[model samples]
Target: MAGIKENWVTGVGFGNFQKAYQIYEKEEMIFRAYVNHAHNEYLELAFEGGVIAAILMALYLFLLLIAFTKIRRDALQKTAFLSVVFLLVHSLADYPLRTAALAMTFAYMNAIIFHRGFAECRNQSPELVEVDHNGDKLFVPVGASP
Candidate 1:
């Protein structure tokens, strides 16, 4: 009984590494919370929901493509359009949080492509953005919403 109490007090003696102990405790808490919320048919319902969402997003994209004309001016407009599509897909797939990360990545690539002002881009790093252009100075303005 005493040994069990000591183990409980120190988070099962994984405290030598504080980060590991914290991670273990957090995982334990998450497990407990999930267990408390468990429903036997939840996974089946979630799976069906995901399938429906995928079909819906597909149909939506198909319709949008049908609506686009050759005279359409901006590719950025399409990027924003697809971004919204992916966002709805994310929500319909039951993950509303994932879209933000994906949108950041997609927007970064779009910035490197369109806003960088180059027919052929040269180099990029995790921390630095660079491009090689002939005469055009493509600058994306601050506080610009798209």
Candidate 2:
């Protein structure tokens, strides 16, 4: 909070969180181990890049919610929506987006949600194949037909 109070406009600059945190660390808390993040993603963003960054993140999330609502009927889209919900919920306790792998996964899911071809694919039912084995019949996607 002290860090944000001091740098609320433009922040201490990205990647400089540790330095800023050091300055704000209370003398009594100094015995504790150093922390590079605020433990909350939104507060971390505001601490690192200022209020504008936080606002931008909020706008991005709002847009994602709108997109999710528009395509929630599709199974794939529903999965994407769940992934986003997980990320948002997780952000309250950890900075998952700061991790490269998680960030890439988030980006990938967003790409899947926004891809133009997804809408077309959703409208087309998968071709199916009927298979017979041991006097039993089963149906599978055409891609798995044998």
**Model 2 agreement with the true structure over 1-146: per-residue lDDT tens digits:** 98899899999899998888999888888865678777898888899899899889989888887787678457887797789789989999999999999999998888877776767765667787888978999887864312
- Per-candidate total of colliding backbone pairs: 0, 0
TM-score, prediction 2: 0.77
Top candidate (TM-score)? 2
Q: What does each candidate score in C-alpha RMSD?
A: 18.0, 6.4
Locate the minimum summed-lDDT window of 10 residues in model 2.
137-146
Among these predicted structures, which one has the highest lDDT? 2
lDDT of 1 by residue, 50-121 (tens): 445335546755755554432144566566556655654555435443347765865564343334333222
TM-score of each: 0.25, 0.77
